[model samples]
Structure formats: structure tokens, C-alpha cells
Target: VQFSDSVSSLGIPLNRIGTTQGVTVSLQSCTNGVIHNSGWTDNGWCGLGSRMFFQSTGTHTIRAQVREDGFMIDQIVLSPVTYLSTAPGKLSDDATLLAARVPVLTSTVQVGIGTNPSSGSTPLSVNFTPNAKLSGGSLAAYRWVFGDGQISTQGLPSHVYQSTGTFTTTLVVTDNLGHKASNFAKITVNNPVTKPGTLTDTFSSGSLDHSKWLASNEPAPGSISGVNYGSFVPGNVDLSKGMLCLRLQQQQGSSGVMSVGGQIQSVVPYSYGTYEWIMRTSSTSSTPNGSGSRVSGQVSSGFTFINNSQTEIDYEIEGGHPDTVWMTNWTTVNAKQYTSATLTAPDAGFYSYKFVWTPGRIDFYLDGVFVSTHTVNIPSASAYILVNHWGTNNSKWGGTATVGVERFLYISRFTYTPL
Candidate 1:
């Protein structure tokens, strides 16, 4: 018999069922022009190995001649050296059955799942990737369960979360040998506030609107802008006297005197817009002076913020300078431009403080009068609108707080009109 294939070796399965005579065989390699002879005698079943050294990988031929009649010869197997090592003898009449009886070595399949942007506001888009590893087998299939009643058969998939909830995404993979592996990842989605073309809040309802605002609650004692003695607590914010009040209070704790501040931020973000606040600071001075009755050592601010990027635009009134309102804009925390705008009566009554944020510029106004304009470091990213009242011990900035005094910043109205 002659055979031609693209292999480096062959496995010959032979069986002797009813004969005791030995069989002589000769294997001649056409490429190497070499002939090798061997005798097979004591074989109920066994795979005889032969090697052919071809200089390159291409078609080659081998010829086999049998010198006996009583011995039975099964099909010759074209295989590599590694496969022929485990090749078994004739197990059945089918050639495939003979190869199937060989024991194969394989390793466990491992699947790892990965997701990008795992948490965000709806409708959030997330990208998922799978890392599959296996030895002695190839990956055959991939299955994904997106945790939203949706399934996929793709190796890499992107999913959109339309509602608000935490979801567990799963990936299951199978190898060519039917070995399976699975992994999972968790994703969180939040409902975002609806964006309005124009908005107005008067605080006349006597309660903070849950749909529009979120009061800041920093219960951990920490510092902000070097004010190390206090934290911003949600309890310090309230609706009273037909206005939104942000209060600052001081109390003696085990560590010593501690302060609490108040803050509220808009739920939806704004980009180019006109933002306004009709507000006034609390007065500790009994006599009204030309500089107004604003208390020293406190800060009242209305600003726009992108927390992750540190982008901001500010209108801050520092009680240390009762008559000055700092107007500022920033592209980053390290990049900023600011100026002081003098106010005639910052604590006596409610006055409109507004900022017109447009492309390339931010124009500030106090009591509807144009105060200043900043053309440098104007933040281009959308940010949340926020107002806060707090006290600091930094004398040059907010000054040391009066230990027993309770301060407040009252806002009667706030509005935003998008441009």
C-alpha cells in the first residue's frame, strides 16, 4: 500500500486474531528514497510507529509491503510525533473509532469577565470583554447574559442600561471539548434628573424638592480648602421663612469645637446658561454699617462644579471681606482667573447675583448690574449648580468662626435659562 499526506510520521495499527505466524513489513519513503523493514509477530493489537524526515512541509509518500497472509493490518494513521505517541490499536471497524480510543490531555478552561464604566446615570452604555484561557483545546462558544433579560453569543459586546438599578452581567464560555466556565461583573445605574429648557425654584413650597436638588451630607470630619474643623451635613440645610436656608453651626465635641455646614446642588447639569440666585447672608452685627451687617469668618457661595475634573465657576462672599464678592472661573483646579467685585449691601437684603456662562467667556452680575467678565480658563464641560454656606478657620480666607454664633445664607429664588 502507498500513502501520501502532509505529515512527518505515521502510526500503523495492526492486529493478529487467529494466526501465530509473524508478518514482515517494509516501509519505503519516496522523498528520502530510504527503505526500512520490520517484523510484527506478538500483537493482539498495537500501533507501530514510523518517521519520515522531510526537509520541508509538503506532500510526501510512503509505500508499505506485507510479506505474510495470516496477519490483519488496520488503516495507517497520518499524524505528528505527539499524536502517534498515544495512538491506540484497532478498537473497531471504523478508522475514526481507532483514533477516538486514544487518551488526550487537556487543561481546565478559565473565563474572566471585564466591564468598562460599570456605574453611571441612565441610559448608560457599558463595554464588556472576556478573557478566555485554555490548553490543549480551542474555545468553541461564548454566551453572555446582560442581566436585563437579554442574552448574546458574541465575544465582545456593548450594552445599554435604560433604567436605574444594579445589574449582574455574566459570561459563560465553552471549549471544543465541551468544558464550560463562567464569570460575572456588577453594574450600577442611576436615574438622572430631567433637563429643562428653563427652570425656577422659589422655595415657597416650604420643602426642598427631591426632584431638583440634593443636599450634601459629608458626615466624616474633614477639611475643605484648609477648613479642618468641620463637615458639611444635610441637617444644616432647610426651608424656612419662605426661603432656602443654608445654616452653619458650632458645637463643643470630645475633640473640641466642631462646625457643620450646609450645601445643595442641582440634580441636572448645565453647560451654557444664565444662572441667578436672589440671596442674602446672615448678620451678627447689631448696627448696620456702610459695609453691611455681614458676619466675619463665614463663606457663602454659588458655583458650578464638575467634581471629577475640578472645573468650577464661582461667586463667593467671604465675611472677612463683607463688601467683596469673588468672581472666578476655572478650567482646572490649578488653572483659574478671579477678581473681586465690591458689594454695597450683601447682608441687608436679598440681591440678585448672576453669571452668564457662554462659549469663551463668563460674565458676572451683582444685583442685575454687570460686575466683571472673565475670558480666561472658562470651563467648557457641563457642571452642576451648587450653593453652600460654611465657616473656616483660615483667617486670610474665611477667618476663624465665632464659637457660639449660628450663621445662615438665605435664598428666596434660583433660576437657570439655557442658551
Candidate 2:
């Protein structure tokens, strides 16, 4: 039995009740699928005494069945009483042959709010689209609350904010039956500001600036793959000919199971900034046992690291697909990962890879051309900049390196400017 009540407490009646334990009843609030257990009670099998409190006043479903044999029921009693005490059964006067009827509504309303160009200069033009997921319901209207006191009835409208601040945007969806659901997202705006002086290094001095870079030698977390392996090799980082080289090589071990790579991290942590780097990647040519070419499986990446792997943004290039670049954004709250479209890589030569990180968004660019923008799960903490080339056994990411083969990624220049 399913019904809606403005208040809690319900009266029920059962007939042909056995002396033994009768049926057990279970109720569920369909709104959130919460199950409420109502234990066995023998109050003459029909009374206003068996009262159950609903956690909420929405639609509910009730089910009853015999816990023992020889138990039967005829009908469920509906009461107008807001509260019920230990009242005696009035079966003959209150019992009915039918249960109260309520409209069978299985539909639900859901809304998702998304914005384009989520963060930019003041007076930013943003198009808000309410992605509505309506199941078995007739949508009557869409109400958009822009968080700025402005309202709109249009389903999907483009609104331009003429201010510089973070705004909470919400969308409420209503069904014909007056049921409503809402979802919210944040929009950030900032006044255009000049670039705050950049720190650039070209590695022409033939040695790492120890004050700015740190050599990281730690075990890569195993959560990404099934096994935890790989460590930083200090010898692999070479500064020669005005280029910083990160080399990846398979370590000495039985069965070709271990490998080592190079990693470098900036000593200074950054919060919101534009990070850019010019790099080209290459691997040694090879043929596996004279049959097919064995391509190197190296992961060359530049990214910002806050505390964990879950709170970072990355610009990664894999040796398996030398011409493809991947952009990723992650948040530690839900461990949600947002990835961008497959960006075409340069055919030959070093290319510019950059990402602008703000309070509410992160934008990716390749060779000074806009690649993609991600507005969800933006990080808001200081993070150190890192660059590395590594080999992983995880074939999905970067295949394990072949035994005794070396792969290298070169960075001609790197720069960062606070925004």
C-alpha cells in the first residue's frame, strides 16, 4: 500500500488472525528508500494503537505479510487521527473492505546545473544549462535561481554576470504533480588582473637550481594500479644543452618486473596560477624478437600536487600515443575525475602545454590554443609543481618499459605566473 499523508501515524485492521505470531509489517519512504522496521504486535489484530512515525511527509510504501502460518488479513484501516494512544479495537465500526486510494506516482524529478567558461574576467558571459532527468513524470516547468536574486522560467538560458565574485547557482525542476527537485553549482568570476611576474628556467646553467627544485625519491602509490612500484632515479635527471631531461629505464630485476623513473618537484608551493612548459618526448627504437616493433611505454607529465593524488590537475603525454595529450582534474572530496577531450599532439618538436587554475575552474591549452575547460571539483589549496617521466605496469595508462630500454622526455623551458 502506498499513500501520502500530511502527518504521521496510521490505523490498520486484520481479520482471521491466529493466536500464534501474525504477519510482520515493513514500511519504506520511497523518496529516499529508507526502510522502517515495525516489529510483531498483537493488539487484537485491529486497532488504532499500532502507530508508526514517518521520518518525512512524502510518498510512502507499506508491505505486510504473514510471519507464521494460518494468518490472514482483510483490509488496512485509514484514520483521520493525528495521534493515537493505546486505543481499543473498534473493528466492526471502523473496518472497511477497501484501502484508501492515492495517485500512483513513480516519477521523480532531478536537475543538474552546468556552466560554460565558469571562471573568467568580470562581466563574463555564461550559458547555464539545466540537465533535467525526469523519470516517469511530466515536467511542468524549470525554475532557475541564479543566486543573484535574478530568476528565469526558461529551461536553459545564457546569463551574463557583471560582477566579480563567486555565485551559487541553482535549478529547481517541477513536475505536473507539484513534486520538485533541485541541484546547485558554483560560478566564479574575477576582475582581469595583470600577470604577476613569471619565474622561468631554461637549464642552460648545466645544473639544477637547488633552491627551486627538489629531487623526489618515493614509492608511487599502489591505488592507481594493482601493484605499488617505481622510484625516482637521481641519475636520470640531466641538465645538458639548455634542456632538462627526465629518463625512464627498466631496473635490474628478475622477469622484467621492476622499473625506475625520474621526478622533480618545485620547492615552492603555488595556489592559483598559470603553469606552462615546453617539452618533447622520445623513446629508443626497437623490434621485439625480430617480429614487431616494441614501442616504449613512458608517462611524461607536468602537474600540480596538493597533498594526495586525488587533489591534482595534470597535463600528461604517453609514449604509447606520442601524438596524444591528456588533461585531467581531480578533487579529493569525492575522488571524482574530470578529463578533457583528446588533444592532438604536435607532429614533431616541442609544444607549449599550459593550464590556468583558479578558484572555481581549470582551463587547458596547447600551443597557446584553448583545448578545454573543466569547472567541477576545482581545488582551492596551495600545491607544489611537479614534472616527471615514469613507466607503469598498468597497460591502460602507460605500458611497462621493456627490459634494458631507455625513454626520455626533455623540457626546454618551464614558467609559472601567479594569477
Candidate 3:
């Protein structure tokens, strides 16, 4: 038999007829100058294996010679040694033999993305299209990781970048054979447009509005004014009785006492605004320790923050001193200024607390009355509005927690007016 393409090995099927004794046959490959002599005692067909590596793409020949009179030749088979190791014994069909003889050609797998308008201003919406190619394979899945902590599994996905920054969007594709390929695109967003508007949430819906706020779930627990303790968890936040409630508690863990806290922050950053909240500090009345004595070791806060730079403006009440509210502002972690305002009844009911922030100064007001003003260290950057209730170990500041006790901070309303 002759082949125009390369042949790595040859298979010869032979049978013996009208004889019980063995019949011998010789199969020889002319390309590699190798011969294989085989014999079969039974009457049925049998194959002889031979190695004849043909590296070049040219004509190859295999010659068969009968060594016994009873031996009858069937058909010649060309196959690679690697394929014959896994092929069926009978060598039944032409399609199976063809697949074994022809080498599989595999091209490189690739993935890419096309964005509608790659760069734009803040609050930009862009549609994405995935371009993927795989030779002899089909794409099975698509995963998109948008730079701003968002992900999608759709092939064609649209995303809105709310803040101004440079984001790298990536698309990962998986083929049917479990091969993966990934590609990335850079998206630039700038020129933030601050629309003058008002945002008010009264907690009337009996649930946290996802459109405006995101419940905090910190990856690990951290210390604020004391020892390393619990972290902010979304499970601790509650919206009921037309108010937002933040819970602080201690639970028994395998490692010892584990503290759990609650927090929520606005989805979008605000700049130059009057931020107001009708809220009350956490008290011992909610704890097993009962009222009269303040809930120690806890700090309840309503503040604005830009985390990367630690720029902030805050109104915080220490559970150890419920009658005093700390008003502070920070341009950075080291540069800060603060003052204390006396509260008439910190745990009795919700009181109006507000701060008007401008580029030059920030003024604090308690129950519509002027409390304090900060002329220096006023943050000029846009920041998220956050409310949190957490425990600390600092004796002079947050004090020590009464283990297994729970404390709560209640807020009836929150309003933000663009200045």
C-alpha cells in the first residue's frame, strides 16, 4: 500500500484458512527500512505492529510478503504508534482508520473584547462584546470582571462606571475542552458631573434601599481605638420601625470572644453637601446591664469618608460618655481637628445632627443649634456617607465591652442636600 502523506507505522491484518497450525506473514515498510514478521495460530484475523516513522510530507510504501501457504492477506492499515495503543482491536471502519492516520491540527486559542466607547466621563455606560476564537473547539463560558468590584457571566454585558477613575476590564473565556484564555481592556472615566439634588431616606420601606446604600461586610475584623475585635457585617444591620438600626454584640467563638458590628454607606460619593441625620447613640438600656449606665466600649458614628486618603468629617458618640458627641474633620490621617458637644439626652430619643461642608470650612449643628465649626482640615474630596456601630477596647475612649451584651444605635432619617 502507498500513501501520499506521512505514515508513522503500518498494520497488516492476516488470517489462516483450512489449517490448524500457525501461518506466518512479513510486513515491511520501505520508508524506514523496517520489517515485522508475525504469526497467528487461529483461523480469525490478526494484526502485526511495526514502527516506520515517516517524518517528511511525501510518498511512503509498505510491502507485504506471505511466509506460509495458508495465510491470506486482508487490508493494510496506516496508523501512528500513539493512536494504535488506544484504538479498537478489530480496526472496523474507514472513518476510524482515517482519524488515526491524519494528524490533528490545533491553532492557538485567543480572546479579545470590543467596547462601544472606551473612554468617557463619570457615570459612563459602556457595552462590551467578546471576541474569541478556538480552532477545533467551541467556547463554553464567558466571565467578565469589571474593575469596580463587579462581575458578570454573560457573553455581551453592559456596565456603568459611576465614579471617575481608570478601570481595567477583563474577559475570560473557557473552551469546551477546558482550555481558558483571557484578555483585558482599559477604560478611562473622568470629569465628574455633580447634579444638584436632594437625597432623603426615612427608613419607611422597612428595608435598606440598595439603590442608595451598601451594607458593609469587612473581610477581617479591625481595631479602631482599642484592641483588634469584630468587623462590620451586613447581618448586623436592621431596618424596622421606620428607622435604621445598627447592632453591636459579642459572641463566643472557637478562638474566644468575637465581636460583631453593623455599618452602611452611601453607594455614590457626595461633595459640598449638607448631611443630616436624626439619630441617637447606643445605650445600656438595650443591653443586659440595663439603663442609667451608658453602654461602654462602643462607638456609634455618622460620618463622611474617602478611605484611601483617610479624609473624613465625623459626628461620633462614645458609649462610655453618651452625653458628649465628638465632632471632627480630617484632611489626612495625621492632620485632624476635633471638638466635643454636650447632648442633653443622648439615648432618650433621636436628635437632629447635621454638618455643612464647603471648600473653605465645615460647620456642625446639633438640633438646629450651632455646635462647632472647623476652619482648617476640611476635606474637599468627594466621600461616602457612612453610619456604623462598633465596639472598642480603649478604656478612656470606647472603654471595655461587657461581654455577651448587645448595643444598638437608632436613626430615623437621613438627608443629603447638594450645596
Q: Which candidate is the best by lDDT?
A: 3
Q: Rate the local accuracy (lDDT) of all candidates.
A: 0.72, 0.66, 0.72
Worst 10 residues of 2 by lDDT: 285-294
RMSD list, candidates in order? 14.1, 13.3, 14.3
**Backbone clashes in model 1:** 0
Give the TM-score comparing model 2 with the true structure, all chains together: 0.49
True lDDT of residue 408, candidate 2: 66
Worst 10 residues of 1 by lDDT: 36-45
lDDT of 3 by residue, 1-419 (tens): 22323333453322222223222334333223222223112112223443344545444444444546544454444544332333233222213222335555344578889985677677889899998887757888999998999999998999999988899999999988888889999988998656547889987798999999999999322354334466889988888645788888865555544678899988888889899999877864552123534566778899998764456999988766778899999977888989898987677777898999988799999999998889987777678899998876557777666677777888888999987
What is the alpha-carbon RMSD of candidate 1 to the true structure?
A: 14.1
- Clashing pairs counted in every model: 0, 0, 1
TM-score for predicted model 3 compared with the true structure = 0.53
Per-candidate TM-score against the hidden true structure? 0.52, 0.49, 0.53
Which model scores highest in TM-score? 3
lDDT of 3: 0.72
lDDT of 1 by residue, 1-419 (tens): 33343233343322222333223333333222322122221121233533333344454555545556543444454444433433242222223433434334344898888776677779889989898888758888999998999889987899898999999999999988998999999999988745567879997797899898999987422344433467788887888556788888766555645778899988878878999999886565322222335566678888898865356998888767878889889876688999897887688877899999999998999898998889988787678888998766657887666677777788888999999
